[model samples]
Target chain A: MPRFNAIFFKLALNSLKSRQGSVILTLLAIIVSVYVLIGVEQIRMQTKQNFNSTIAGTDLIVGARTGDINLLLYAVFHMGAATQNISWKTYQELTTLSSVEWAVPISLGDSHQGYRVTATTPDYFTHYHYAELQPLQFAAGQPFEDVYDVVLGSEVAHKLGYQLGDKLTLSHGLGATSFSVHKDKPFRISGLLQATGTPVDKSLYISLSAMEAIHIGWNNGANSNAAHSVIDTQSLTPKSVTAVMLGLKQKTAIFRFQRVVNEYRDEALLAILPGVTLAKLWQITSVMEQSLRLIAVLILISSLLGLVAMLLASIRERQHEIAVMRVMGASPWFIFSLIEIEVVIVTFVGYVFGLLGVAMSFELAKNIGLEHFSIHLSSNIFSIDQLIYLALILIAAMIAGLIPAVMAYKQALGVRLD
Target chain B: MKTSILIQNLKFSYSPQSPLILDIPSWHVEQGERLFLQGPSGCGKSSLLNLISGILPLTQGYLGVLGAQLDTLSGRQRDHFRAQRIGYVFQRFNLIPYLSALDNIRLACIFTDQQQDSKQVEDKACSLLISLGIEQSHWHKASHQLSVGQQQRVAIARAMIHQPQLLIVDEPTSSLDHQSRDAFMQLLLRQVESTPLTLLFVSHDHTLSSYFSRSQSMNEINDA
Candidate 1:
């Protein structure tokens, strides 16, 4: 039986070699679809992981009444303008509560060359966490010391070509082409944070006093003339904060504390469970994954149909060669098995080529995903699911091969060798 | 003495509704006898060969080859019997065009139940190619790249590689001119004489019968 298989393998190879052009073209289709399927799956998983790890360690986020995802998008991600700011008196009162261990007030609504500028106390760095409570680490220098000292996120420093002691003025608003620059109170880069593969990588951190000093003369979102305003950082205080991230002293008191802030008598403040809100944001990103998978599945179906078409057409051209073999002592089963094995070989080879291509392309995507989106895209060559896909591709290929195999078998049995 | 073929009241038709294509009252060929049968095209010559080779079913006949009744054997058994004891050289010399001459000959050994080491199969192929006047230069070339004469020799070598007992040559020299035809006939006669080969050479050309040990017309025996 093994010897018969050996002979059949050679015969199949001879047949494929005779039609190398069509065989290679069919293989290319399989390779491309495989690559696309694996690529989309990897990117989907990476994006999910990135979105999930964006906020951690904070039990509740206190913002003005807004949507859960909206609060998360603006407060944690610095994506949009907050509709209302939390009163400083309310933040101070919230910190005094026995259930609150720490409250880090964050102020946004400023930009420096497209990077959001976040004004917060040094406590923000000590308590803030991401990716399983992973603490923020500095790549160079310490956190801000003087009011004019600023700390740059890893991406911000790397992208803007800034080093410690380089001074940069903040823009009045969040636009990249802002004309209202706060040139009077320029802040020097005091530190640089390590790349965390999260939203923190694209932010500029500074003390709340600096934000107040920069906007001292600004009115109605415009930088006022400096002729009468030389206010010192010590004399000004942040009038309001965009949101406050709270960590509970007792994890069990989180619900009670959130209720106290949500129904506070002084203002219309909203407190949300960060975990639940981040999950809501993740739903939007998952839609991207579904669309990509749908496209990949469509491509896979087309390629498989193409594979079946090529094999069926080849069977018509191979009737003469098969008749010759049947007379040369090859049985009908031999001819049938040859066609099946030929398709299997093509699928296996195309799968390997596609896998290699995916690995190479993802190697580049990993870096791009990190630098641009702060998403840690893994470049794992062959995950278990990918192996399952490989098995499925081969099985589908064998099933597709059966149609042509039956045709060839019938021809072999019916051919007249005269 | 064992008979190579025995037939009595054999009848064959493509389907039940069609007229019989082959009808023979009685026929026999002793073992080791060389029989050359000639007939015009479409005269049931190919049908008779198909029945003798067990390619067609025999439901109403006492057809036997080498003491085994072909009518009693199943389809698969007949296929194995043909592959084991019969080698056929077709009219068109249908060698796999892409395979080398040696590989084409080795394909015969692949279908047999007998196992041969690679060295043994290679040795046999080399000897057959050499004896059949296939030179070293042409043996390594692809079957299609060889001249018509070389391809014919390769096909014969392939058919004889398993050393089948009954060798059937169907219009082996129909494509050749007189000079090359004489050369091929000389080579085929010389090769078969050395083995205990029962040759059944079929062709319409009667001039070649002078070289065969036995000669008869297929239509004379087949009454349809």
Candidate 2:
């Protein structure tokens, strides 16, 4: 039986080799569609993973009154400037709440090169956790100690080619091309953080007192050197900070803490649950995801149809071949199975090549996604969903090839063989 | 003499609504008989051959081949019977174009009930090719690369590879010249001398009738 099957396989292989041009064209169509189908799925999954792992181990993020998503974008992601800053007095009072175990005040709205510069106390390093409550580890030195000390995230340090003890100044605004540069007080790079595969990898960390001291000799986003003080790290205290991340001693007290923060008497602050806000963000972008899904499915269907059409066209040309095989005692089922074997070979090869193509592109684009977009695309591309898609593609190919196989079977059974 | 084929009250048409194309009342051929049947074009010769080879069902009649009642067998059984017992050769396009001559010959043994290893099958093919006067250099070349006479010889080799009991040749000499046709007929007759093979040769030209032991026109046999 094995030898018999081997002969049939040889026949199918030779038949495909005989019609090389059409076979290659069909293979190209299948490869491209597989690439697109698997590519879209990988990106969708990686993007969701990147979003989910941004911030963890924190109960609530308290920021000035704004939309929950907006607060999340500015406080956790540092994507945009806050509408209003929380007063230092209000933050101090919030940290004193009985349920609050730890608090980290972060002051945003500064830039170093193209990366965001976040100013916070040393407590930020201790309390911050991400990606399954993994603590941030230093690749070089310790966290910021003096007012002029600074730390760099992995991507920021790598892209800027900075090392320990290197001094770089910040800009007053968050644009890539900032007009107001703070070149007066250059901060030393005290430490570098290992890659956490999160937005934190694209940020520069500095002391909050350094943030206040940089603005001392400036007014109204302009540098007035005439009234500039020499240097004062002692009286440098931030009057307002962008947001505060809080961790409660008890997980059950989160809702009550969020209510207390939201209904605060002194300030109009809004507190948000990060996971709920992330779900809302997905809902807002679900339409784009659905459209991409539809496009991928359409391409898959058309390519499969192209494969079927190619087989159907070959059936007409193979009529003589079919007649010859029939005269040699080949049954109608043999003819049918020959075409099916060809389809299986093509689809399986096309699927493998498609996966290789995706992996190669991921290798080329890994650094760019990490450095620029702060998205860490992992190298492991296989998932349960992708395996399911492979099975679906194979079944679809077999079902599609059935049309031509049946045609060839009927032609073989036709009464014309001399 | 042992009967190789028997036909009685055989009736055939393409479909129930189509006109009858063949209506043979009775016909029989003995074992080891070299019979030459002649008929002009469009005289139902091909249809009669189809019926005899089990390619067509016997709508009404008793048709037997090699002692097997072909009319009682199912379609798949008929196919198996043809594969195991009968060898067919066409007039033109006799070989699969893509396969090499050796592969083409070996393909004939795939459907039969015989179990032969690859080495044995390949040796059989090589011996048959050598006997048919096909050069060793041409054995591995694609069937299309061979000349027309060479292809026909290869077709004969393929038809006789499995050592069938009945060999059906359909106008295979029409494309060959007189000398090659004489040589081919001589070779075909010599190849079957070792076994008691019943050979049925059909053609439109009657000049080749001298090569057979008996001759009959299709009009004398088919009563359509």
Candidate 3:
């Protein structure tokens, strides 16, 4: 290799080695900031990925007239309150659309503790797809085959400590508060679905007729309620549902079918594209994302400021050393370059360690998050935003060192050879 | 004798509004001249040496070293000239604490772009240490690990390693005891005698000036 400017590099290396403790401390501060930045970014990206993948293979979510965001909140995630509920007749009419390939009705109203209770058909387990079009897989037993049979998601089972053949009653509303449970008829846990790292992980799945069956004894016996009250397992009927998920035969006809469902005068219904509604949800949360990004940047700035302060504080102690180097023929610029080079080296090392920390954090989060919120952490760490963040860190570190570097240069200029 | 350093009507002030610290109407030193410039504390002896070496830009008048005008050179050019032609030994014997004595000596050669074989440089540095009465065992020790007297010897080795035309010694004996000071001055003068290097030894001890062929007091050089 060609000879380096030894006066430059040697001074930098020697200065760093002489103040090894302070240099290491500064490097550690940078590493911590980088770790936090990458950590927050990884969670944000993975959260979005998890949200988008929560309900795949569904072309449209048809529900009561509401904004696309509210429709998605209630229909798919079972979050927030429903603005409206589609009647059973509207769901039937949507199922009859020529463009519809398969339609799965969902009724959401109750909860088993914090986990939402979703009432749907067997097709939810058979035809439903999540991330990468992967259909739901049972980690324990089979999907619900009877009206009063229920399938608990992995999180719901793990959190509530429920097992196959366990019987549980649903609470009246979706909130955490529970006044009464449908204790007269409890649903038996027929299966536990594998963790999908989505809302599905936090929901209880039962047949629509089972939901209707639980409410059958109320309201003085309407025929619709009376029909679902019969304990003769084969004699129940689901009179109404909250919403329906539809997959189209031809994706090109999604808008046409959505319009068809929206024009249904029989009930106040709305058809929302899951992808479009996901984008809307992202918009609603964009402010939070921006604020988080800003906080990460501010933390990085503070870390760099700490680095600058540390380096500047050491400048006084190194003044004699710098004067010695100056007498040895090293220029003021050489000293400046030396300080800058140290910062760059530390920054590069911190960035590498930060990326490693992010990867490790993601691995840890993957396991815990799946068991908790069903959000899968992605393995890709070098996203464009992360690269930009790394670049910003480098620039910021260099800028931080500039203060000490300029001071060193000025001191060197006035240095006397006494 | 060839003029190694020449100062003409040179004046320096710490600030534009401050009183003049040094005002040398004229001074000249020949090659191989061991001139002991003696003065008490606050007498601007160090400031004059700084101006001759071009570490401090002359505020007024001209200075020439080895036939090159220092004031005409840019900061970078002046630094290169200083590295190539001048060596300095400070009062504290300021050697980088982490570096071995040999490495510290080699740093001078490295900066001057005067490549020397490590074995040859090590042999020369060790020989200098031995000549200075330092033991062989302390040659490879870090500068800080060595005693203050030993570190002063190492600083002398570093200043002489590159064999520059001018050697500036700044009160190297100030911090030494009487016996150590006498021994250090003897060893330092012997080394300077072996090389054709001009010596500008600044000190407050006028008794030490009798050893030099030429001597001047700062009181005589500056009217202050």
Whose DockQ is greatest here?
A: 2
DockQ-based CAPRI category assigned to the predicted complex of candidate 1: acceptable
Which segments of candidate 2 are over 4 A away from where they belong? Answer: A1-4, A87-90, A93-101, A132-134, A137-141, A154-166, A176-184, A194-197, A215-240, A248-270, A382-385
- Candidate 3 clash pair list: A197-A374, A197-A375, A198-A374
* TM-score, every prediction: 0.88, 0.90, 0.87
Which model is ahead, 1 or 3, in terms of DockQ?
3
lDDT, candidates in the order shown? 0.85, 0.88, 0.82
In model 2, pairs of residues that clash are: none
- CAPRI category for model 3: medium
Rank order by DockQ, top first?
A: 2, 3, 1
Name the lDDT value of residue B223 in candidate 2.
Answer: 89
Better of 1 and 2 by TM-score: 2
Q: Give the least accurate 10-residue stretch of model 2 chain B, judged by summed lDDT.
A: B48-57
Q: Which ten residues in a row have the lowest lDDT in candidate 2 chain A?
A: A1-10
Over the stretch A38-130, how does candidate 3's per-residue lDDT look in tens digits? Answer: 888778888887788877889988888888788888887788878567777777777886888999988888788877999998998877888
